[model samples]
Target: MTTPAPTALQRPDGSPLRILVVDDEQMLTDLLSMALKMEGWEVRSAASGFEALSLAREFEPDAMVLDIMMPDLDGMSVLQRLRQSGDDVPVLFLTAKDSVGDRVAGLTAGGDDYVTKPFSLEEVVARLRGLMRRAGTATAGGADPVLRVGDLTLNEDSHEIERGGTSIELTATEFELLRYLMRNQRRVVSKAQILDRVWNYDFGGRSSVVELYISYLRKKIDAGREPLIHTVRGVGYMIKAPQ
Candidate 1:
């Protein structure tokens, strides 16, 4: 049986929530990227406090996921700088420091929420969604529980993907693109449109970004598997269940 979808909220103006993820560890950065993208949030990653500041100015994320431990500058320092610069964007601190003093310090330093390391992806998404709701950035109510097309199933809350009862592992970008297509299933989506919706303003002026990512997605979601994402001649792409 198909999973029940979330109650319909107002459409998100066809825009993905811009999110900045900062972590010194490459693996954690990549995992956070994957998890947030699965929830249809546009994500950018940074490894240092300076880079995080630069991204806050450039990307102007609606929210930030900051790791408290890093060389040269800690998450609190970064948040301090952002607040000093008058960037009051909501911040959620993710770190190994879970002490009461640490949480108090983070909140005092302008963090909206403090999450310890080894957090469940679901919890992170839930917190981010709550932050978005409180900030009045996203639709104020719940979102669709599951986004699907054909046999492919995306559990928005659980961040699980299944095809014909077989689970699939998709990278962050892949998950975001698939979710976008599934959300607009049956409608032709152009590369330009995809770039605008998926990659945010940093399309990097590269038109082929979408194509490259699409190729990557096809390898995992379609190669040696049934085709769900399709290319439309001289047009763009579309996702439809096989006829």
Candidate 2:
């Protein structure tokens, strides 16, 4: 029996969400495209990183399923270039390398999620649905689409952030981390919570990834300014407006 489409797959306008599937393997790309289309989503596939980059600009997809081991330009390079160009589209990395370091590299390079190859199509679909929901929340229309703490401003709809009137570029992962911290400003958030919410992984006892991304955020959002991210010492991390 075919799985039913999740309600979250629909956009705010009631249109189907668009997804770009990128893989060097033609068979994998075709398989993913067919599966995503079954969920009533608009699916586009690219067999190489170059084509993926080009289609991403023109398609402006809501999310992307990217393969890590591509010839010429790999998935990490494609994602990094996209983040540099200020495209905050959510990306899920597919790879045969399931090591801890591999996952960390993908997340640090700005991917929102990761899936090992020989993965279940159901799991991939579920992960994509989760990503779509999170992205929707970030860009959801409301009376206030922007979050603020001190001089730092994050516009959810535009995926833009500014601090002290200076624009700050953030990768998709960085943006999500900052948003979570800003949402709970003044409240300490544990590393476990961050891993679950931001990375969508449960690394347990391996919370170094949180520290790394926090440092990345600090370099961009806190450097040369009054520090906003603070370690609670023996606890977690917190962000608050400067006194």
Candidate 3:
């Protein structure tokens, strides 16, 4: 038998990443915990949204896999509460509903990604890795540690951002999106490129996700300032210093 590939759950310094899996189903949580632990990650699970919220505060996981259709407090409520408390830990929603409306709702509600029911274990692992990476907690050390475009700055090491001498907070997904754009600086990146680089998913050619995030960045990064992010009509988007 061929040896299975290892799960990407360790930081560059060899520390195991912590992940919290929340679901009402015992078998599902158990299976997820087992698979996560097999990747050498610290795994925690909660059978209810209430327990999940409590554990989230205590565990402070690097990422969360949350089930939406839970009894009592639902995933949406849990996530909303966390956000209300200023917690921006990356979240991947697990739902039986795969409708566009459902996905949009989750994303709009601060979820980083989603996985439909009957997802492959490999796909879950991949999606979690992508979330961790975007959260800027996957790697320990790197060169250049910072990127700057005009007055806006992003420190990869600290996972902090500032614009025009003002500190700005960004969710994990937003940080990754801005980083990709600032890294490309003067180059206009197509929506397809942005999806591939930021989301690491084909998303079934759904370019609206990119548009939504760009609007988000605009409100956060460009509001009340000379816009650094520019739309290249009918093409994609670009970030560049003000002319």
Candidate 4:
């Protein structure tokens, strides 16, 4: 049975929310970016506090995900500067520090919410949604929960797939991989990017797993039909409608 589509938060003007993600870790940023984009939000990332501050001014994001510790500058100082500049964009801090004192210091320094290290993408998305809602900058995004490319369609709420008027079955992992590709239709996504976006990094991050799944998806999605998925040699893969 299909479940209800979870409402995605959006700007009051019915535009997708813009989010800024700041972290020194590239893997974390990639993962977070993928998840945020899937929710229909525009996402930008920075690798340091300085770069984050720069982007925040120009992007004027609806909300921010900030990492607390960095080599260049700390999250506290970044928030402090933003507050002093009269930009009250809600901030959610990511910290490896789990101490009460550290968290209190972050909150006291103008952070609106926070999650500790090794946090779930769901929690971060949820917290950002809450922040935007409370700030009156966001509301329910839209009614559609379907992603389509060519004749293929995937109902996010139903977890169902169909192509060329036929039903197709996918494992959980296959579903995620396909969803990522469809979301990025016509755009090449490297194996590393797919690994970060679709599978757990803890799975040893094997590119072969990506290869194996691509084959699985190929048999299910492309066999006996015009191929929507294509491989860019020495690069990655992309999905797009056939000419």
Instruction: Tell me the whole-model lDDT of each prediction, alpha carbons only.
Output: 0.78, 0.84, 0.84, 0.86
lDDT of 2 by residue, 1-243 (tens): 111223434777767789999998888888888889998889999988999999999999999999999997999999999999999999999999967788888988899998887987877887887687776722232346678888888876688999989999999999989987886788899997788667776585789989999999999999989999999998899999877
| True-vs-predicted CA distance for residue 100, candidate 2, Å | 0.5
lDDT at 196, model 2 = 63
Q: Candidate 3's error at 133, in angstroms?
A: 0.5
**Leading candidate by lDDT:** 4
Number of clashes in every candidate structure?
1, 0, 0, 0
Q: Write the per-residue lDDT of candidate 1 for residues 51-80, one digit (tens) a residue.
A: 999989999998899999999788989999
Q: Is candidate 3 or candidate 4 better by lDDT?
A: 4
lDDT of 1: 0.78
lDDT of 3 by residue, 1-243 (tens): 111232244666778899999999999988888888877789999999999999999998889999999988999999999999999999999989867678889988999988889887766876787688767768633345667887888886688899988999888899989987876788889998788568744578789999999999999999989898999999999999887
**What's the TM-score of each model vs. the native?**
0.55, 0.58, 0.58, 0.57
Pairs clashing within candidate 3: none
TM-score of 4: 0.57
C-alpha lDDT of residue 175 in model 1:
78
